[model samples]
Target: MPTCPSPRAPNGSSSAQLPVREKELTRQYDLLASARRGLPMVRVDRDYIFEGPSGKYRLVDLFEDRLQLIVYHFMFDPAWEKGCPACTRYVDALRDLSMLTRRNTAFALISRAPFPKLETYQKERRWDRLWGSSFGSDFNYDFRAALDEKIPTVH
Candidate 1:
């Protein structure tokens, strides 16, 4: 992760000289972050299976013994030949995320597309991040990442 730059005044002054509005906005942003951290957590009871390069794996396996797992629900519909352009761009913009491992967190990309397609795309893009396929599983629908009229949501 990149470090946040210290706030600077328009006149090349210190952050202590920042305008009232900027300070207020920073305070509001901090409060919102605190609220998000305080939100209640839900336990996942369902066992979701995913396909990867090695083989099929359960949802808990994606954690890789890390304290937390961060999954990026990349939008790649089964019928589509390629991933979403926006999602591709976002992945392209990502920097080295190895820093996350040091924080006891693991990250992976989960898509509804078949594993073969995801593997080919990952190789073509030269991305070494862990990618998994949720095809034939309710993982995406249960997480509200994939939408389909035929599949009933698990509200």
Candidate 2:
């Protein structure tokens, strides 16, 4: 959703010195992004499940009839009393969920906290997006979002 600036003449002002190679690089990046969408998907056999707003659901269920799903692995540990402040801030940026739904894509959050605690933190942040807990499951580990049992220092 960004517009490309038009190339300026040699006599143009100082700020108008955008390189022609930059535009070509941008085009190449866009092509790569388009190609990434067509990458082959490996079948998942594990019955990984999560606790959701409406009971428990599997990983595929998170897609919610959409072909593409974006799951943000929130770093909220089970022992933490409150959700991560940084993750909370990132969630605040996704206020408009309709944009993704319109594009046939769904987005959700998965955390390591238990269902009840995850629910409480979500309520405190007043978040409306779909969130689930991977507490009794290996969803986080399988996805490599959670590294071992140690919680990383945020500071």
Candidate 3:
């Protein structure tokens, strides 16, 4: 009997695919799709204030009326001593994410950094992706990314 070559994972390792039950698969998919429904339809179309190199822009308008929003909430708050390297990696990879808007999906990065601060960081890191600083906004609070004083730091 001949053996077949296993599929290679992105990490250059061979891993066997896991088996799945058809019924359970269907249930998982349905639950995920339902998350987008049963909401008061928070108008994700409204343009919010955002500044770029050229000038200011309404954030939602940049997507050109796409499938709502795909905001990448980041940890660029002043509370942190420095920008997160993990977050930096994500932002660096995100420069090529224009496809999201091309696929009719609005894409943006939300950070607590002031626009000027973010601009400085971007220049230092050589980041060229479209990003926005949500200064003076409750975006972090609304999205539950805000730091909780009650929660103790494990590290």
Candidate 4:
């Protein structure tokens, strides 16, 4: 860790305050990560199928024999003219997947849009990750990523 000398601020605060704050932030982040790692895992038995560029594929197929699989639920509704910008931004971080692959982990993107639309948007965005479509599938609904049409009105 690097520490900088704290110069006196206009309010008479020492510049050294930043190092303390950074250390505190780092400690909090470590604690949060430890708690996250302690969370329980839920086994998924549902055989959900998704549309891929080549053909339909089951959820396990995305892993490609990897020990772990990470599925990113992208916001690309069937009616939308384009994919969500925020979700697309997430893909930028995955440009270099060598680190993840070395750890025996696989990553895939799933959306509610049709395969053709996903393909078009993926090409436009130039994303190299595997993208799948959950259209006509209960995946989005079951995963709580998409809302159902029937909302029970409160009396």
Candidate 5:
């Protein structure tokens, strides 16, 4: 009977040779990270308003006194009754983000749908994450999240 070959590394070589390749990959990743950090930054000059569960809030308020803020552009057109299925799936896959708080970072989800609709959906999904509505505001368009001109205007 013929014996199967030993398990190989991702490059099809023997696993014993992975140490050198792993070090090279680690260096490449470190360099890529440094390049990303050196990229130019754009300053947000406009004071956009968003409606949340409590009330209207300014863009700066979303930071929650954190040093950094990460916004997830959720796709939920004003005319649609429900949010985009792909965006919903992405939200569903997210695990606990408490680590971001400990790191002095804040996260929020922004969508073009009305605040009422967002509130209903949030309740249905049982998501307690910070969510805000950019409805009737230019925040979505300015951020390039709502680029489609065919979307119906919210009245």
Candidate 6:
């Protein structure tokens, strides 16, 4: 979540600088320093293993001559072919991700669809990049991405 400042200021300067309190400034500075000292991570893993149509692979496999793996999950299940429209919407927006590749990081897309299904989708989208498919690998369930807390799903 983020703050939404009023479009117009009381004095109407046409723009307003976000106000940061002393405590907030201090906290932000500390966070910045910590980030400079070491990269921030949402979750770190060194020993995760997954399977796919090709074979078994480790988290490091996604690194591919790099040191970081940025992965996005796209829904591509054949059973749900013409897959979940909502998920498709998300995938459709991820067209250009070259900036992530400019650095020493590898970006991959993981999906439940088989290689063939993924190939078809990629062809339709005219996507040139390779996106990893982990169908039957159960990686989604293992990562808790396929589980629905609201309902008992086969995930």
Decide which is better by lDDT, 3 or 5.
5
Kindly provide the TM-score of model 5 when superposed on the true structure, using C-alpha atoms: 0.72
Worst 10 residues of 2 by lDDT: 146-155
* Candidate achieving higher TM-score, 3 or 4: 4
Q: For candidate 1, write residues 1-155 as lDDT tens digits.
A: 79665675346556656677788999999998898789799999999999999999999999999999999999899888889898899898988888898999999999999999999899888888889999999899888778678765332
Q: Give the alpha carbon lDDT tens digit for every residue of 72-100 in model 5.
A: 99989999989989889989999899999
Q: Between which residue pairs do clashes occur in model 5?
A: none
Leading candidate by lDDT: 5
- Better TM-score candidate (5, 6): 5
lDDT of 3 by residue, 1-155 (tens): 99766554444343433223566788887887786465565554434576666567776555657766777776788555457788888777765666775787877666777788778887898977667777776656655676657543221
User: Residue-wise lDDT of candidate 4 within 1-155, one digit each (tens)?
Assistant: 99664455544466557768889999999998898789799888899999998899999999999999988888899999798888888886666888888999998999999999999988988887899999988888776777356632111
The alpha-carbon lDDT assigned to residue 45 of candidate 2 equals 84
Top model by TM-score, which number? 1
lDDT (C-alpha, whole model) for all candidates: 0.88, 0.83, 0.67, 0.84, 0.89, 0.65
TM-score of each: 0.73, 0.69, 0.60, 0.72, 0.72, 0.55
Ranking by lDDT: 5, 1, 4, 2, 3, 6
Q: What is the lDDT of residue 101 in candidate 3?
A: 58
Q: Please provide the root mean square deviation of candidate 2 (C-alpha atoms, Å).
A: 7.6
Positional deviation of residue 110's Cα in model 6 after best superposition, in angstroms: 0.8
Error of 6 at 154 (Å): 16
Residue 23 in model 2: lDDT: 91
Which of candidates 2 and 5 reaches a greater lDDT? 5
Worst 10 residues of 1 by lDDT: 8-17
lDDT per residue for candidate 2 within 1-155, as digits (tens), equals: 99655555346655365666679899998998888778798888898889988998898999999989998988899999988788889998876778888999999899999989989988988888899999978778776687475644321
Candidate 5 overall lDDT versus native: 0.89
